[model samples]
Target: MDAQVSINDSQAVLRLGSRFDFKAHREFRDAVESLLGQAGSRNLQVDLAEVTYLDSSALGMLLMLRDKAKATNKDVALVGVKGSVKQVLDIANFSKLFSIA
Candidate 1:
């Protein structure tokens, strides 16, 4: 798993690659935390276009991220989800808890 983070005053984007599982925990958490730490960064867009797979742990990670984001007054959006990644999120009904694009 790989994560690339980009942030600005208006928005923050985290681009994920390949598998998104527990292996991504530390990097994902760091990226999100860095973005949330920035002043005026109220929106976080998680780019899933390059992600091909995800496990239940990934869902838990997302939920944790959401909780942290909420605590920091930030909103999270998952973007470019497709194939198995999309299916898993759909099955988990994450759209109800996040903004999926």
Candidate 2:
């Protein structure tokens, strides 16, 4: 997976590539976590349009990030989800945990 992180003001956007699975989990987590930690943003938006597959580990990773953002009084949003990826999030009831669009 590939990721592009961009920030403007207090908001950060993470553009995720296809196939967010266990193989890319560590690197993805590190990049996202670093940005969320070092930046001054209170909001994070994850773009998932390119994602084609998302496994249990990926779901867990998202949950972890959501919880961390909440604990810091920040917000996390999952955007551009589609197909199987969207199904995974829907089945897991992630819409209630974070903003989904």
Best by TM-score: 1
Model 2 residue 67 lDDT score: 80
lDDT score of model 2? Answer: 0.86
Q: In model 1, where is the ten-residue run with the lowest total lDDT?
A: 32-41
Backbone collision count in every prediction?
0, 0
Model 2, 1-101: lDDT tens digits are 99888888899888889899899888888877776775589889999999998899988888888888887888889999989999999999998888899
Candidate 2 residue spans exceeding 4 A from truth: none
* Per-residue accuracy of model 1 over 63-88 as CA lDDT, tens digit each: 99899989988899999998889999
Q: Provide TM-scores for the models.
A: 0.95, 0.92
lDDT of each: 0.90, 0.86
